[model samples]
Target: MRLIDSYRDKKTVDILLTQIGNINVKHKYRFMEVCGTHTMSISRFGLRTLLPENINLISGPGCPVCVTSQGEIDAIFDLVKNNDVIIATYGDLLKVPGSNGENLYMLRSIGFDVRVIYSPLDVISIAKNTGKEVVFLSIGFETTTPASAALVKQLVKENIKNVSLFVMNKTMPRVLDFIANQKEVMVDGFLCPGHVSAITGERLYEPLVKSGFACVISGFEPVDILMSVKLLMEQVNKGKFWVENNYGRVVKSNGNELAMKLMYEVFEDCDACWRGIGIIGKSGLKLRDNYKEYDAIERFNIFIDYDKSLPGCRCGDVLLGRINPTDCSFYGKRCTPDNPFGPCMVSNEGSCAAYYKFGG
Candidate 1:
C-alpha cells in the first residue's frame, strides 16, 4: 500500500531525528504532549525511541474518557438505574467502570438501555422514534462540545421534550496555568492539541507562553509532531517562550469562531474534576441556565454523591509526568487492557494502554 503522506516515511523521520541529535547542549527538557492522540501517535510511530536523550516527552491528562472522574461515572450509573432514561454515548465510554465496577456496557448487558452513538444528534432519533425518554452522554474536549451544542439547538428547534444531555465535557486552556504552577513537577514546554487548537485557536494557549513555557500547536502526523518538537527546541535554545503553530493548515490564530460561539451559546464554564489531575477551576463545560431544560442532570435529579478512583491506581502521577504507567504495581499485573483495574487501562489514548501497546 502506498502511504500518501510521507511524514511517516523512514527517511524523513531519520532526518528529523538526526537534526534533533545535533542540537547544542542545554538542560534536560520535559515536553508534555497535552493531547491523547499525540500520545497514541508518538507510541505507534516509535517516536519516543528516536528522541534525543535530553528531551523527554510526557503524557498529560488529555484523554477525556480516562480523565473522567469516577464520581461522574457513578452518577450516570445512578441515573440509568433509578430513572427511566436510556443513555446514548460513544462506544469507548461503554466499558469505563464506575465505583461499583460497572459501566454503561455492563449495565446494557443486564438489560439497561445504553445505546452507543457516533453523533450526539442520534439521541433525537431515539427520542423521535421511541416514546421513551433519552439522555445523551456528552463527553470530550472543545473539539466535541460543538456537536453537543448543535444537538441541544436541534432539540429546541424540534421541540424534542424527551431528550436531554448529561454533559461531561471539558476545555484545555484553563488547566495549563494550573499545571504550569504546580510545585511537584515542572514541564519545560507543551505540545498542544491540533484538534482542540483548531476550535480554540493558537491564541488560547498564549497564556502558557506568557508564563515562560514554550507552547506549540501540533498536528498528529509524524512530520507534524517532529516539526513541533523542533520548534520547541528552538524556543529553548534561544531562551525564548512563545506560542507557535506548526499545524497552521488546520489551526488559526483565533480558531473557529462559529464553533466557539455555538459551544458557548449552550454551555458555560464550570469547575470540574480530572480523574488523576484533581479539580481545576472553569475547566469543565456545563449547560447554560437557558439550556437547563436540555440538561439530563437536572431532568433526572442525578447525584454523584460519591467520587473516588480505585486505590493504588497511580494514574494521578502518571498524568502529571511524575511517573510512568509501569510505575503502578497493577499496570501489567491486574490492569491489562482486557480486564482493566484503572481508568487509564481502558482508553486506547491512555498512557497505560500506550505503554502496553508500544512498550514503556
Candidate 2:
C-alpha cells in the first residue's frame, strides 16, 4: 500500500478509535496539539467529532506566524518602509497585519520590493541578480532552522555582503515548558510537533515528561493522530507521564544530530517575544556573534518595544488554549480569512484559521 493510503486507511482509523474508546477514563482529559499542522489535520479529518466527549483537544502557540509578536510585525514594516533592501520571505508572512495596519502584501502592492521565496537559498540568487541588499525574513521552529543556518553558512563562505537575515526563528521546548507550568492552561498531554521532533528528537521532550506531562510525538496523518490520542489517554489515565513516540517512522530518540549541530553553530538562544503571550526567556534563536555582519536587526538599528493587542481580539487566549476561536466575538463575524485583524486569522496553520476553515 502507498504511504498516505496506509496512514489514512479507514479500517485502521476505526480500529484506533475503538482502542481509544476502550480506555474508559472518567476524568476530563485535555490534550494540546503543539504543531499547527496537527491542528489542521485534526480539523480536516474531523477527528474531534469521532473522539469521546471526555477527550478534549486544544491548540497551542504552534503557528509560527500567529505567535510572531505584533512588535516584530511592526519592525518588519519599518524595515521595509525605511530601507531600500529587498524583503524575501515565505508567503504566509505577507498578509499578517502590523500594528500600523500594514503588511508586506500591502507594501508590495504599493511598490516595495517584497518577494515570496520558497526556500532561504532563493535570497542568494535575489541578492546576486538585483545587486541590491536582500533581507531574508527567517521564521519557523526547529524544522526550518537548519535551512536558514545553511543559508547563512553559504553567504559567509561566498563573502556575500548584500544578504542579511531578519531571523524570527523560535525553539519549541522552552515554550512547551511555559505551557506545562501554567496553572490556568490545564494541558494533560502534548501531541508534540512531528517535524520539529524529526530535528530535535524524543530526548527533547524528556524534560517535560519529567515535569509530569504526557508527551507524544505524533505524525499529521489521521491514524497517527488517533494513535497518539490513544497513547496519551492511556498514559494520562495510568498517571504515567512518559514520552511516547507514536511516529517512530520519522522521529528518533536523539533527533537529527547533523541538523542540530548546524542550527546551533549559526544561532544561539535568546529571549523571544510571542504575540499576546509576552517574552519567553531563551525561547528564541538569534544569529551568533560570528555572523553579526549578516544580522538585519543590528544593521538597521531596529528594536521592538511591545506588542499591541487589538481590542476584543482574544487571539492570545486562544493560543494559550484558554478559549476556543468560537468564543471570540470576531472569529467568523469580523475576522474572516480575507479580512484578517490578527495574525491568527492570517496564517493557514493558525488555530483560528483551522477552526474557521474546518469548523470546530
Candidate 3:
C-alpha cells in the first residue's frame, strides 16, 4: 500500500491495537517519552486514545527551553540589558517568563537588544560582521549541540573575539537517571527520543535497560510509535529489558561519532539547574576551559541570582512525569501560550502547549 493510503488505513491500526490487547502486560506499564516533539506528535495523532488503558504514556523533561532554569533566563536578560552586548537566541525562548515576570522577548520590546536567530551559524556571521559583543543564548539537547559546537570551532578558527556562547546544553542520560530515581513516579519503560539517540546512540541507554526498564528508540510516525508500544508490551510480558532501536533508518548503536567528538571538544559536563527541578549534577554542558574565550558567562562576567518559579505553576511536576498538564491548576486557565505562567506552557515543544494545540 502507498504511504498516504497506509496512514489512513484504520484496519492497520485496529490490527495493531488488537495485537497490543492480546499481549498480556502482566503488570501495569508506564512508558515515558522524554522529548517534547515526541509528546506533540503522540498527542497530535491521538496515540494515547488508541493505547490500552493499562499502558500509560507520560511526558518527560524533553523540551530544552521548558527545562531551562529561570536563573539562566535571568542571566540571558542580564546580558541583554547591557548596552554593550547583543543577545541572539531561538524564537521560542523569547516568551518563557523568568522570575519577576520578565522574558527575553519582553526585554527586547523594552529595548534590551535581543535578536532571534534560527541557527547558531547565523549568530556566528552576525558576530563576525558587527563590533557589538554577540552572545548566542545556546540551549538544547545533543541534537542542537553539534551545530553550536561547530559554530564555536569556526569562531576559534577565524579568531573571532566578539562571539560568545551561553551554554545551557543538557544531556538526556543524566535527566533520565534523575527521573528513574523519583519515587513519586514509576516508569516501566522509555520510548527514547529519536533525534537525541541519533547523537548519543542506542548504547548510551544501556544503563536504563540494565535497570530492568525497556528502552525503545522510535520515530515520530504513527506506525513507528505503535510498533514501539507493541515491542515494549512484548518485552514486558517476557520479563525482558533491553534497548531496541525501532528507528534504525536514522539511529545507530554508536550514533554520530563526529558530532559527539565536536561536543566533547567544546563543552564539558557540569551541574546545571532546571527551572523547577533544581540542580541535577553533571546534567548540563559548559564551555571547556581551553575554549573559555568563547564562553558567554565568562566573557560577560554575568551573575544571576537564582529565582524561584512563580506560585501556582506545576512545571516541575509536569517535567518529571509526576503530573500531567491537566493536573496543574494554571493549565488552560490562568496559563496559556498567549499568557504563559510557566515555561512548560510557553515553549512550543512543551507538553502543555502540545495538549492545548492538539486536544488533551
Candidate 4:
C-alpha cells in the first residue's frame, strides 16, 4: 500500500474500528491523549464516534499556550511595558488572558512593542540588524525546544548578547507523570504525541508503560490514529500495558540525539507552574547558568507575582482531563473564541476550540 494513500483508505479505518469493537475492556478505561495535535485529529476525523462505547478519550494539558501559567503571561506582558525591549512570540499566545484583563496582542496594539514571529530564527535576524533588545517568548513542548535551543546556539557561536529567551519550555514526560499520579483523573492508556516522540523518542514513555498504562506513539493520519486506538484496546483487553511505536516511520528509541544534546547544553530543568495544574517540579526548561546572557527574565529583572484565574472558568478541570469542554457552564455562552474567558478557549489546540469547531 502507498504511504500517501494509506491515510484516506476507508477499508483500513473500518477494519481497525471493527477490531476495536471486538476487544472488551475489563472495565471502562479512560485514556487521554496529551497532545493538541492528537486532540485536533481525533475531532477532525470523527475518530471518537468510531470507537467502542466502553472506552473514553479525554484531552489533557497538551496545548502549551493553554497550560502556560497566568503569571508567565503577566510576566511577558510586563516585559512588553518596557519601551526598549521588543516581545516576540507565536500567534497562539496573543489572546491568552492574564490575571488582569491584559494579553500580549492587546498590549501590542496599545504600543507596547510586541511582535509575532513564525520561528526563533526571525528573532535572531531582528536582533542582529536592529539596535533594540529582543526577547523571544520561548513557549512550547519538545517539538519547538530544538528551534529555541538552535537559536541560543547560534547566539553563542556569534557571541550575540542583544537577543534573549524568556523560556517556558515544558517537558511532556514529567507532566504526563503528574497526570498519571492524579487520583481524580483515571487514565488507563495514552496516545502519545507523534511529533514529541519524534524528538524525544519512544523510550521516554517507558516508565508510564511499566506502570501498567499503554503508550502508543502515533502519527496524525486517520489510519495511524485508528490503528493506535486499536492497539491500546488490545493492550487493555489482555491486561497488558507496553510502550509501542506505531509511528515507526519517524520516531525512534533515541529520538533526535543532536537536538537533545543542544537542549541540554543550553537549558536546565526547573520547576514550572501550569495555569490550573499548579507547579510540577523540574518540569520546565530554563536557560543554563552559562547561558545567562541570553536569559530575558534576568536581563529585564521582571518580577511576576502569582495570580489565579477568574471566578467561574473551568480551564483547570478541563486541562486535567477531568471534564469535557461542554462540561463548563460558560463554555459557549460566556467563553466563545471571540471573547475567550480562558486560555483553553483562546488556543487553537485547545479542547474547547476543537469541540466548538467539530460539534462536540
Candidate 5:
C-alpha cells in the first residue's frame, strides 16, 4: 500500500476504534480538536458517531476566518470602499460578511478590485502588474503565518513598495490558554492541531499538559484521528496527563525552528479580538516596528473596533464548544453556507459549516 493510503486503511482504523472502546472510563470526557482541518475530518469521516457516548469530540476556535472579529471584517470593507487599491485575500474570506452585511464578493461585483489569492506570494505579482497598492488580507494560525512572514521578508529584501499586509494572523497558544480556563466549556483534553504543531512543535502545548490537561497532537486521516483518541484514552485510563505526539511524522519537539524565527522576525504579539470569544491577550500577530512600512492599517489610517454583539447568533458558543451548531436556532434556517449569518457558516473549515455540510 502507498504511504498515504496506509493512514486511511480501514483495518487499522477499526483496530484503533476498538482500542478506544476498550478503555474503561466511567466519567464523561470532552476533548476539543482545535483545528479547522480536524473539524472537517471528524465530520467527514463520521468519527463522532463511532466514538463511545462517554467521549465527546468538540470543536474549538480553529477556523481563522471564523474567529476574526467583525470589526476587522468591517475595516477591510471600509478600506476597499474608500481606497483605490487592489485587495487580495484567501478564497474562504471572499464570502465573509461585514457588520453591515457587505462582503468582498459583493464589492468585487460593484467594480472593486478584490482578487482571491491562493498564496501570500501571489500578491507580489498583483502589485507589480497592476502598478497599484495591493493589500493582502493575511489571516491564519501558526501554520500559515510563516508563509506570510516569508512574503514580508521577500518584499523587504526586494524593496517592493506597492504591497502591504492587513495582518489578522493569530497564534494558537494564548487562545488555547483562554479556552482552558473558561467555565463555559469543559475540555478534558485537546486533540491538538497537526499543522500548527508542525510549525510550533510539541513543546508549545507543554504548559497546558502541566496545567493538568491531556493533549495529543493528531493528524487528519481516519486512522490518525482514531489513534490520537486511543492515546488520549490511554492517558485518561492511567490517570496521567501528558503531551503525546501522535503525529510525530510531521511534528517535532521543537517544531520548525527556522520557520518560527522567520515569523517572529516580521511579527510581534498583540491583544486580539476573537469573533465570539472576546479579546484575548497577546493572541495575535502584528508587523514588527521595523516592518511597520508593510502594515495596511497604519498605511491606510484605519481603526479596528469590534461590534461584539451578534444578536441571536450563537457562533461564539459553537466556537467555544459550549454548544453544537445544530443547537443554534438559526443554524439551518437563517444560517447556511450560501447565506451565512455569521463567519462560522462562511468558512469551509468552520465548525458550523462542517456540521451543516456533513451532519455532525
Candidate 6:
C-alpha cells in the first residue's frame, strides 16, 4: 500500500507538474506511450489534460491486443469452424473485431466454444479434461511471453499432448525502431513501456534514443507519468536525445534474465505483421524447432482469408499514430465499445476504448 500510494502522492505530482511548468519551452512535442497500460493510465488519471499544451501524448501500437493483425483473428475463428481445437484465450482477444466484425465471442454466442482464461497454465486442466487439442491464442509483448514459454516446457515435461499455443507474441524494440524511423510520423520522444522494460531492460530503448528521440520508461501512476514528461521536457530543452527510467522500482538496467531466458528457450524471432502497421521483420515470436510439437499453427496448418479494414475505420492509422481516435469518422458515433467496428475500440487498453470510456 505504501509503495503504491507513494507513487500516487499528490505532493509528488504537484512537484513534477510545477517543474514541468517552469520550463519555458515554446515548441510542440509529440510523445508516444508504447504500452497500452500507460495509455489507459494516462486516460484514466486525466494526465493528458494536466500536461503542458506544448507536450502532446499519443498512443502507439502498445496495446498488444489492439495491434493483433486481422489474419490471426480470422484464423482463430476459422479454427473454431474446423471443430478440432478448443480456443482458449485471454480476455481482450475474444471481442476484438476481425474481418467484417466477426469475433470469437460473437461466434460463441451462436454455439461456438470459446473460453476466457487468465493464464497459460490454466490450459493444462482444459486439455486434460477435454481430450481434445487446446489451441491457446497467445498474444502480447515480452511481459506475457514467459508464461507461454513456461507452459510449453511444462507440457513437454508432463507429456501433455492435447495443448498447443497459437503464438502471436510480438517484440518491442524492432517495432519501436520501425515507428521512429518513419518520416511521415513526427515523434519527438517515447514514453516507453514499464513491463516490457522490466523484461527487456532500459537498454532496449538506448538504440532508439541514439537514433535521436527522448525516451523514458515510466510507471503507471499519475505522478510517474508527470515526472517522465518533465524529464522528456528537460531533454527537449537541452536538445538532447536519451533514455531514462522513471519506473526505477520495477525496471532495472539489464531487466529480468529468467523471463527473457524462458522466452528465448521456446521461441525464435520471426517476421510478423501489426494490425495497422505492415510486416515488421523479426518483430514476432514463433516456436523453436524443439517446441514444434507444441505449435498450434504447425499442428493445424492454418490459412487466413486476409480481410481488409472497412470504410472510414482509421484503426490502422490510429495504431501508427497517424491520427487520434476522435479524428476517426466512426469514433464516437458509428464505432464504439458496444458495437466496435475495429480492434482499437474492442480492447479496454486500446486507445480508442480509453478515449471513449474515460471521456479523455
Q: What is candidate 4's TM-score against the reference?
A: 0.96
Pairs clashing within candidate 2: none
Distance from true position, residue 162, model 5, in Å?
Answer: 1.2
Candidates' RMSD to native: 1.5, 1.0, 1.7, 1.6, 1.1, 1.4
lDDT of 1 by residue, 1-360 (tens): 555367677788788878887886466878999898999999888888888778899988888888888888888888888887788999888777776677777889899988988898888889998888898999999999999999999999999999889899999877777789887768889999989999988888888888889999998988889988988988988888888889878898999999999999999999998887778889999999989998888887787643577788888788777888888899889888887877778887888899898875
| Residue pairs with backbone overlap in model 1 | none
Quote the positional error of residue 281 for candidate 3 in Å: 1.5
Residue 28 local lDDT, model 5: 83
The digit string of per-residue lDDT tens for model 4 on 262-314 reads 88888889988887888899999999888898888888897865565667888
Q: What is the model-wide C-alpha lDDT for candidate 5?
A: 0.90
lDDT of 5 by residue, 248-289 (tens): 899999999999999999999998899888889999999999
lDDT of 6: 0.87
Q: Backbone clashes in each candidate structure, one number apiece?
A: 0, 0, 0, 0, 0, 0
Off by over 4 Å in 3: 1-9
Which residue pairs come into collision in candidate 4? Answer: none
How well does candidate 5 match the true structure in TM-score terms? Answer: 0.98
Return the TM-score for each candidate structure: 0.97, 0.98, 0.95, 0.96, 0.98, 0.96
Worst 10 residues of 4 by lDDT: 302-311
Candidate 3 lDDT by residue in tens digits, 234-290: 777777889999989899999999999999999999988886788889999998889
lDDT by residue for model 6 over 1-360, one digit each (tens)? Answer: 786898889888888888887787578889999898888999998888888788789889998888887788878877888866688999898788766778888888988778999999999988889978888989999999999999999999899998888889999988999999988778989999999999999889989888889999999999889988888878877888877989889999889989999999999999888887778999999999999988888788887544544567788898888899999989989898988988889887899999998866
Task: Summarize candidate 2's per-residue lDDT along 172-277 as a digit string, tens digits.
Answer: 9889899998999988889999999999998889998898899999999999999999889888888888889988899988899999999999999999988778
| Model 3: worst 10 consecutive residues (lDDT sum) | 1-10
